[model samples]
Target: MNSLRAILLGTLAAGLSAGGALADGVVNIYTYRQPALIQPVLDAFTKETGINTEVLFLDKGLEERILAEGQNSPADVIMTVDIARLTSAKAKGITQPLNDETVNKNISAEYRDPDGHWFGLTKRARVIYASKDRVKDTSITYADLADPKWKGKICMRSGQHDYNLGLFGSAIAHWGPEKTEEWMKGLKDNLAHKPDGGDRPQAKSIAAGECDIAIGNTYYVGLMRTNEKEPEEKEWGNAINVLFPTFENGLTHVNISGAALAKDAPHKEDAIKLIQFLSSDEAQRIYAEKNFEYPVENGLEPSEMVKSFGELKADTLPLADIASHRKEASEMVDRVGLDDGPST
Candidate 1:
């Protein structure tokens, strides 16, 4: 996989050096999101605007690759998951402020960068998945996870994973570092096993009786439930019920899948147009139905599968604020030895 990625990157750099950016009607993309996930929307953009798009997908090193390419990078727009990546791109000087009125109108202020460096395209909540046969309560709070009643009954991914770090960052925002650390320690004490694997495995653990409840993103449930290609994953999805956990503020914690304009975009105009189109009603609907994520655009509804999870009252805390404390949250994770599970 690493070799293939290196070859792709080498080919891309060579192609860019040879031709610079593509012609007037074309825009290039560098995305952390899989191309298949965003291809439908890109196809729609091409159909409507007659502007062609070229994508270079990478799982990691997106910013570094662009930085390495300097002013000659072919990336016109950068698309990625998580607020931390967006903010980190901005901090690294790889992204520039968008400041477009259409993008601003489509996305809520809380979901976009305050300075216009990035805009959220969709939302997914950090939620709890409880075993359908073992757990019954629908309403749960983040604070409740720390109670001794759940000790040896919880499961999660690595503490340093970006998803958990985002949630931890929110904890710091709401409870302050010291209190959040204490809460994290309590939560760690409840681990069913050493924190490992992605969100889906956590749900699988619940189904297999390894744990009663687990932390995961809301959309993973939707994906697992509808995945016809993998029947076992369908079983994992059916084994749990979604619970919207909140802070004392009465708002659920949510994160974003977002995009930014590349700093040295050679196709700036078309890139901006593509981004604006992504926020439009048609594109938003496509994203919602295709990805099972909440649309950033107001009045757009998520897919019916997602609607089954119940209402999400997303916390109004600015993601930028959450991004600010991610470092501290990570430090606290190590300090409490969260990834070591309860044994340590």
Candidate 2:
């Protein structure tokens, strides 16, 4: 990680030394998303629009790197997988506000920033993964996660993880801070073990008989099913059924994979064109299909693998509301020691 950071920092320094022109017809992107997932879309964009793209894939510190580069930063767009990261880019003042009819028309209001700092490209539900044999409940709700009946039968990633924090943030947004804190405590006490690993590992744990139910994103199930390198993961995928849990007053909680325009972009016009194209139905179809995520544009649908999980009724609670409450959610994670699991 440190070596990758140093390399990116050096690249930024070189851009600064070279006056940051980046040539015409080229868009420089700094993304936290893996290149493999988005490379096909970029290739398609270049082929159709004649605008070459140069992507710098970073696992962390995209905002900090851009901050360090100041006005000399050559980044045209910033793409990442969560609402928190996109909001962080906006909060850091490193992203430009974009106002375009194409963007507005393609994206739903809940997924787009009112100030146009960021726009979500795709959506993912924070759904439940239940054991196919051990768990028989077909209907579930997010609030039911706090029920004592499921104690010690739950598996989860760290509560402090961005995905969980986003869910908790939505809880706070809907249920208020006190109720959210109590729910966090109840959910923590029900953990089968100390929270560890990413979403996929939760399914792995269920297959290992460590837990009966796990919380994970919808796409990890797809990734596990398609994981040719690890055929055992197919077993894990097959051992579970997805359940979209909803809140009492709202629909199921969903987060996004989104993008923002760089504040000091060298190729502004090209950047707008690229973001517009990404929001278009053609690009959205390719983008969502690549990862088994639901497309953000209305009238578009998720891939067949995603649809097989059944329909998702996404909560209309604006992403801006949830993003605003993340800090409190993160603090509650530590306050309740959610990652520590139940005290033995």
Model 1 per-residue lDDT tens digits across residues 36-124: 88989999999999998888888889888888777766789999999999999999999999899988888889989999999999989
For candidate 1, give the lDDT of residue 193: 89
Candidate 2 lDDT tens digits, 134-171:
99999789988989989999999989889999999999
Residue 23 error for model 2, in Å?
1.9
| Candidate 2, pairs of clashing residues | none
Worst 10 residues of 2 by lDDT: 12-21
TM-score for each model: 0.94, 0.94
- How far in Å is the alpha carbon of 218 misplaced in model 1? 0.9
Candidate 2, which segments miss by more than 4 Å at Cα? 1-21
Query: lDDT value for candidate 1?
Result: 0.90
Give the Cα lDDT of each candidate: 0.90, 0.89
User: Using lDDT as the measure, which candidate wins?
Assistant: 1
